[model samples]
Structures are given as structure tokens and as C-alpha cells.
Target: MNRDLLGRHRSVLPDWLALYYDEPLEITHGEGRYVWDSEGNRYLDFFGGILTTLTAHALPEVTKAVGEQAGRIVHSSTLYLNRPMVELAERIAQLSGIPDARVFFTTSGTEANDTALLLATTYRRSNTVLAMRNSYHGRSFSSVGITGNRGWSPTSLSPLQTLYVHGGVRSRGPYAQLGDAEFVAACVEDLEDLLGHTRPPAALIAEPVQGVGGFTSPPDGLYAAFREVLDAHGILWISDEVQTGWGRTGDHFWGWQAHGRNGPPDMLTFAKGIGNGMSVGGVVARAEIMNCLNANSLSTFGGTQITMAAGLANLTHLLEHDLQGNARRVGGMLIERLRSAAAQVPQVREVRGRGLMIGIELTEPGTDEADPRAVSAVLEAARDAGLLIGKGGGHNTSALRIAPPLSLTVAEAEEGAAILERALRSLP
Candidate 1:
């Protein structure tokens, strides 16, 4: 527990392990936008545990719900319906805007993606699934299969590729902006070409905002184009809303809205804020599509009583307090502030994305820094200066994904952006 305590010893974790330890500022506890280390050193949680702790860590209402539920029932088999699970399902269905939807709950985004894969496979009995290049669905086998990124599926695991689409929510503006119309036309053309060349795909999956792909938000037209293509060829659009749901996108409660407004997807996947800070994820598909649905659960009651209690409390907090509105207010403030901040820093490449989900791309390959390294070095420096951030892009291309809680204040947003700006300027 005392790694650097008393200034006597460094941490003892093994170096050979595949551990991600970029944090120079260790974390022990968190509340709102702040975290404390074992030494009681405070750091701003701008990363929000990579945007999963939607309500922020250890919220009072969430704690009360869990504590009260623990005193009652922590878990119950999914075989018998639990009250908390039932309530949680109802809440998710109501919030998701999917009519007559059924919930297949899971513990993590990876598991939820796995469930989506199985359901898609079972429903269509087709061997094919499609996802966008540069997408990160999850780490499990099937999820990894649909994941267009090669890292998720190693060369050894490569079995004829699932077919990678060119433009994703995140694929645009790495160097140049892809017009919404061109991107849409390309998707239609690809689907038509793929359909003619091979069998029709059973399912097509995509993130509304590519979380790991650098907060990529596709232009408003991509969804409609996809829907047209899918409908023409009898494929389903499985919207991976894992990072863009639960009102994180500000303008809408879910990123699918940018698409759903045209028409709802055949299936929708969600995670992150679904349970606030607790672990909960789910899939909502057209009732008829899952009509042949059989419970294919790998999770221990992906719908557990304790998790449900936390989920309900968090959902209630979101609805009652209008966290989505807060996300819009604060997210816009952060975007505007970062725009100004980046203007003063030459290393900043671009600022893009919507609502609470945003990103700032830096000069790739560390052109500004004196010592050459991934431009993500700015992230490490920011963390040391007491602000948490996450970096992404397949080739270590420079970009930081910022999906803070809807509860983040404008003051906190400014402070966090200031930290990021200073870190970028201090490059070298």
C-alpha cells in the first residue's frame, strides 16, 4: 500500500506484465472531478475513469442505493426476476427510446459486445459481421472479430477479415475532413460492392462516436446513408452507442439520435454511464429481430440486484437533474475554451467531437517536443500536473479523448482545459 510512501521505495509491480501505468499521479479515491492518492495528494479526474464513471466516483446517492441494497439483497439469479433488475430494465428501455425493446444485460462493454455478436449471429445465422476500420468494439473473441482494428485481433487470430469500412465516426479529420456526403456515398458503394462480390452481411456495427478512435463523431448524414444501404440489402445496423449514450452527447440522450431521428437501428448497445459509476451494460434490439432470441448469457446475471440499484439511482439522478443539459453547457464551454487554448499552442492539430465527448489532436510523432516520442507525452505531463486524460489512435498518433461527467462544472472544465493547454505548451 505504501509504494512511494515515506520516500523510501518505488512500486513493486512486475515490468513484464502488460500493465498501463502512465499515471504519475496515483489514485486512491474520487468524488466529482477529483481523486486522492494514498498520500492524500489530489488530482482532477478529467478522464472520468476513461469516461465510465458517468456520475463521477462514489456519488452520495449511488452509495446510499448500493448500501441499502447490500443490506437487502446483493444479487439474485437471472432465472428469477429481481426487483432491481426489473426496474433497471424499465429505466433503460424508457431512456433508450427503443420501443418494446428487450434488455440483455451484461457487466462490461466487452461482454455487451459479445452478447450483441451472439445475438446477431443467432438471429441471422450468417457467418459475416461488419465493422469500421479504426473501430474498437471490445476485446473478446467475437467482439474482437468485429473490431476492425488489427490490434484487437492478432495476425495469428486473423481468419479472413470481416471487411473493414473506410470511414467511421472517428475516421474523419485525422489530417483532412471527410465531407459527410462523400463518406455516405462511399459506405453505400462499399455495401453494394460487398453484397455483389460475396454474401450479404448479417449485421453491420459501428460506434456513433468512436471512443477509442479519438472521439470520432461521424457527420449527421452517415446514419441515414447506412440505413438506406442496410435496408436495401437486408442487413442490420448495430449501433455501438457504448460511449455515446446516457446523454453524454448533450444534444441527444444518445448518439444514435443523430441516426435514430431518421429511424431507429435494428439493435443498440450501451455501456459507460448506463450504471453511472457502477458496472452495467445492455443491448436493445427490435423486438422482432430478437424474436427468436434465446438467453445467451456469459455474465453472472448481467442484471444483478446491486448493480441494478446503482443503475436506477444513477438513471434517476440523470433524469431528475437534467445531466444531459449540463453536458451540453459544460461540454460547449470545454470545446470553446480548448479552441482558444489550442490557438495559443502550435502543437495542437484539431479540436473536434460533440457534447461531453471531445478530443484534441496534437502534432503526431512529437514534432513540437524536443525529445521524440508519441505526442501522448503531453498526457503524462498533464497527469503529473494533476489532471487525468486518455490518449488514443492506432499508431500512437497524438489525440486525447475527454468524456467527463455531465456533472462537470464550467469552472472545472476551464481548469482541466488549462491543464491540457499548459501540458501541450510545455512539450520539450
Candidate 2:
């Protein structure tokens, strides 16, 4: 059954779309932290469908909300008043940390980022954008142009002239050996130097934790320091929280808070988990920036009643249950468990991340060289052992991504960690 489905998928889907494992399993259904494949095997879903499943699969509240909203109205477009959309927007705006925030919804993170680009360029009246050295915003033409990760970037042509910045990866850069304070200072100097040689950029966009770049993060307060420099030049700071938002990081509700000393970003883009499997993405910005799109704009399917309903239900459940606290407590334990396991394996170069967003970078036994093949082998072995994880990195996808749903339990964490340990041990 899996083979036949794979053949059909390959024939219909675009070739650029990648799949996991040598023999990919078809996930038919899921409940809580587990999913069942077409072959009647169950696996702990640690990657949470690329971190799109923020809460859990088949969450009763979100499921009921989606069903009821669909029964009433699937979509009415942005042409009409959307109460559910308005409510969701209000909630997000208040939580955004940006005063007088305005929310515009989209169907995916790509669109959310594209919207941000349009706002920044038009508002600042400049096309020059600053991006991190190994950052990925989205796949759209504008978003992809600012994305610095070569593995994910498909084309060089772009409407925006993007300048790459430093300080995204803390462990593998020229300034890697520096202490946190010195590292931040060095990166700031680099940014100043880059600015000296280029035109005034409209905005600097970055991810707090680079998801596709193997969950790498700069030292805390790095963005805050950059914010000081950007503010002096009146450049916008757009935080791409596509993979780091909705309290997955454990320590904060938003990943940008790690650098919040200089205040929230000018604009923030988000997606991947808020809708709890429904299609929901959006940007939150101060009124001055969000309203810069002069003429008129609307995403036809953005904030459809169905998706808004799901987002509202999911958000309510997340907050009411204090899942952020759950993420903090559970994620702390899980990371320590993985760290202990990774310490025993020489191929495991590093284990990093906050909250539930963890990454295990693989390298050759006695060397710093990344081992992408070893990453693939462990991923395959983990699947065979009834666990589902993910792979990502700028170094040829050499890191294992382990972002489970926010509702992960202690027992489930232990189970997944043991499976992962066995898989890692199998590597050379």
C-alpha cells in the first residue's frame, strides 16, 4: 500500500518537494503525540509534521471548532466581515507586544513573510534588505530572495537586493570562540561594517531560532543590540516567528523576547502551528507599518472562517492549559535526557535548542566535519524503531530536528528519547 501511494504521489507532486526516509511511510491518522501509518504501525511524532501541528493531532477542541465552522461557513473571503477572524486578530495583536498592533492573516508562512517584505519596502521606500547568513524566511520570490541558506534557495533573481548578515550560528562562525558578550559585540561590528558599504536597507529580517538551518540561534540579546543600530537608521526589524512562535521555545511566549530589551520588532511574521493543522498564517505590526500598503489588499482565502475558528480554539486551549509552562517543564527534562544520550555518541556533535524545539547535529567521530549520511541513517533507523523525527541544516541537512507537539507528556518524551538514543548509537 505504501509503495503504491508513493508512486502515485511522485507522479502527481512536484519533484522539488522532498520526503523523509528511504522508504517513506504514509501517516494516515494521529492522536495526541502518536500517529499511525498506512501499514498499521504507530510512531511517536516528534517533528509534529514539520512543526505545523502545534498542539496535537486530532485535538478535540480544534477538531470540533473546524467541524462547526465548516458546517456554518467555509469561507467568505476578505470581502465580508469575518467575526472569527476579527477575534483571532484581536487576540494575536494584544499578545504581539507591539503597541497598536494590526493583524493581517494569510494561508501560510510564505505569504506572511511576503506581506512583511511588501510592507517594509513600501513603508521605508527602499528595496535593500538585510538577512542572516543562514536564514530561511519562506519560498515565495520575495521571501526566498532574503533567505541566505543555499540549500533551500532555488534562484538568485529577486526584486529586493538582499545583504547577508552574520551572527545566526553561534557554534560555527568566525566569532564562535568568543564569549556571549564578545560574540554579540563582534556581530554588531560586522553589521556596522556591512552597513557602511551599502545603501540604507529598508528592514532586517531574521528568525530567532533558524528552523531549517538546524534550529541554530545567536546568543541571547544579539537581536536587541542589532535593534539599537537599526533603530538609529530607521530600518525595520521583522521577526520571522514561523517556527519559533506560540511558546514552543519554553522560556518565552515569543522567541523574540530573548532580545526584548530594545522592545518588540517593528513587525512579526508567523505560521506553522497556530492553526493546529489548519492553514493559518499572519503578520502583526504596529499600525504605522501595517497600514503602509496604500491602495487595497486582501488574501482571498486568508483568515477563512474555518481556519480562524480552528486558530481561536487552538489558542484558547494552549493558553488555558498553560502549555507554555508545560513546554518549559517538559522541554527542560527532555533536553537533559537527550543531552545525556548524545554525550555517549561521538557522532553527536551538539544538542541545542530551547523548549520543545531541539536539534542534534551530527559529525564524523573524531572530526568536526558534518556527517549528513549519518543523519539520514539515524533518521531511517528511528523510523524503523517506531519514532518519527525530522532532518534540517545548512550543512547538507546534517542535524536531527525534534519538535514535538506542545502537549507532549513526560512518558512520551522518555519513550522518544530512548528510540532516538538507539538510532544514534547505530551510527558509526
Candidate 3:
């Protein structure tokens, strides 16, 4: 059955849309942290459908809300006064930390980011945008234009004149040897130098933690340092929190909080996990930036009633249970366990990330060269051992990504770690 579906999928779907595994497994259903393949094989899902399932699989609150909302109404254009949309928007506005916040919903992170780009360019009145080196914003033409990772970017032409910046990864590049404070200073100097060379960029867009860039992050307060520079130049700061938002990072509800000394970002884009598998994405900004568009705009299915219902329920459950705290506790144990396990493995170059968004970077034994083959082997072995994970990085896709649902338990974390440990050990 899985083979038949694979054949059908390949026949119809774009070849560029990648699927995991040597033999891709079709997940039929899920419960809590586990999912069953079409053939009845169960695996502990650590990646959580690219970290979309926030709280749990088949969460009762989200399920009930989705069902109830669908039974009443599902499709309503943004023109109407949708109660669920209004409620979710109010909650996000309060949580966003932006003064006089306004929210606009979209169907995916790509659309949300595109909306943000529109707002920033219009408000700042500049097409030049600064993006972090080895960063990925999204896949659409507009979002892809600012993406700095060559592995994910397919085109050179763009509507926006994008300038790539440094300091996304703290442990690599020329500043790797510097102390944290020195590193931040160096990146700020680099930004200042770049600003001197180019037309004033409309905004500097960055991921608080570069998701597709192997879960890499600069030292704390690095963005705050950059924010000071951008503030002086009147450039917007757009934080792409699609993967790092909603307490997934453990220590903060929003990833931008790590750099909150300079205050919230001028614009923030979010998707994935908020709706817990439902298509709900949006951008939040201060009224000045958000209301910059003079032309009217509307999203056909942006804040449709059903997705908002799911978002409201999921957000409520996440906050009520304090899943951020759960992510911290369980993810802390998991990363420590993985780190201890990787310490003995020469191919493991680094273990990094906060909360449940951990990454294990693989390198050739005793060399700096990325070992994507070893990562592939480990992924296959882990799947054979009844564990599911994800992979992403620059150039070679060398980092193993482990982002489980926030409701992960200690026992489950232990079990996943054991499987991953064995997979790493099985590497040849």
C-alpha cells in the first residue's frame, strides 16, 4: 500500500518536494508522541511533522474545537467579523509585545513572511533588505529572495535588493573564536560597515534561531546589538519566528524575547505549531508598520473560522499547561543525554539549541568537513529502530534535527535518546 501511494505521489507531486527515508513511510495516524505507518509500524515522532504538532497528536481540546467549528462554519473571507479570528488576534497581539500591535493572518509562514516584506518595504520605503548568512525565511519567491542558504535558494533574481549579513551561527565563521561579547561587537561592526557601503535597507530580517540552517543561533544579545544600529538608521527589524515561536524555545514565549532589551521586533512572522497541524499563520507588527499599506488587501482563506478555532484552542492548552516549561525540562534532559552520548562519537561535531529544538551536527571523523552521508545513515538506522527525526543544514544537510511535541515526557525522551544513541553508534 505504501509503495503504491509512493508511486502515485511521485507521478503527481513536484520532484523538488523531498520526502524522508530510503523507503518513505506513510504515517496514517498519531496519538501523543507516536505515529503509525501505513503497515502498522509505530515510531516515536520527534520531528512532529516539522515541529507543527505543538502540544500533542490528536489533542482533545484542539480536536473538539476543530470539530465544533467545522460543524458550524469553516470558510469565511477576511471581510467578515469572525469571532474566533478576533479572539486569536487579540491574544497574539497581547503576547506579541509590540506597542499598538496589529495582526494579519495568512495560510502559511511563507505568506506571512511575504506580508511582512510588503509592510517593511512600504513603511521604510526601501527595497534593500538585510538577511542573515545561511538563513532561510520561506519558499515563496518573495521569501526565497531573502534566504541566504544556497542549499535552499534556487534563484538569483529577486524584487527586493537583499544584502546578506553575518552572526547567525556563533560557532562557525571568523568570529567563532571570540568571546560572546566580542562576537556581538564584531557582528555589529560588520552590520555598521555594510550599512556604510549600501543604500539604507528597509529592514533586517532574521530568524532568532536559524531553523533550516541547522538550528544555529548567535550569542545572546546579538540581535539587540543589531537592533540598536537599525534603530539609529530607521530600519525595521523583522524577526522570523515561524519555527522558534510559541514557547518551543522553552525560555521565552517568543524567540525575539532573547533580544528584548532593545524591545520587540518591528514585525514578527509566525506559523507552524500555533494551529497544531492546521494551516494558521500570521504577521504581527506595531500599527505604524502594519498599517503602512495604502492599498486594500485580503487573504481569501487567511483567518477562516476553522483554523482560528484550532489556534485559539491550541494556544489556550499550551499556556494553561505551561508547555514552554515542559519543553525546557524534558528537552533539557534529552539534549544532555544526546550530548553525553555524542561525546564518544568522533563524527559528532556539535550539539546545540535550546528547549526541544536541538540539533546534532555531523562531521567527518577528526575533520571539519560535513558528513551528510553519516547523517543519512543515522536517519535510516533511527527509522529502523522505530524513531522519526528530521535533517537540515547548509550545503550538506549535516545536522540532525530533533523537535518533539512540547508535551514530551521524560520516559519518551529517554526512549528516543536510546534509539538515537544506537543509531549514532551504528554509523560506520
Global local distance difference test of model 2: 0.94
> Per-residue lDDT tens digits of candidate 2, residues 147-166?
99999999999999999999
The reply for model 2, stretches above 4 Å from the true place, is none
lDDT, candidates in the order shown: 0.75, 0.94, 0.94
1-428: candidate 1 lDDT, tens digit per residue: 35454233244554432323343444678888788877787778877877888877788889999999999988777877688888888777776677788887888888887777777777877768778877888877777777765544553253223877756743443322546676667666866787788787778888988888777666776777778877887888888888888888899887888876557787889887867767888888777765666765345768889988998888888888999999988998899888888787766767887888888877643353222243557767776787777777543444677878779988888889889888877865
| Per-residue lDDT of model 3, residues 8-72, tens digit only | 99999999999998899999999999999999999999999998999999999999999999999
lDDT ranking of the models: 3, 2, 1
CA RMSD, predictions in order: 3.4, 0.8, 0.7
TM-scores vs. true structure, each candidate: 0.90, 0.99, 0.99
**Least accurate stretch of 10 residues (summed lDDT) in model 2?**
390-399
Residue-pair clash count for candidate 3:
0
Model 3 lDDT on a 0 to 1 scale = 0.94
In TM-score terms, candidate 1 sits at: 0.90
Candidate 3, position 381, lDDT: 96
TM-score preference between candidates 1 and 2, better one: 2
Which pairs of residues collide in candidate 3? Answer: none
Clash pairs, model 1 backbone: 170-216
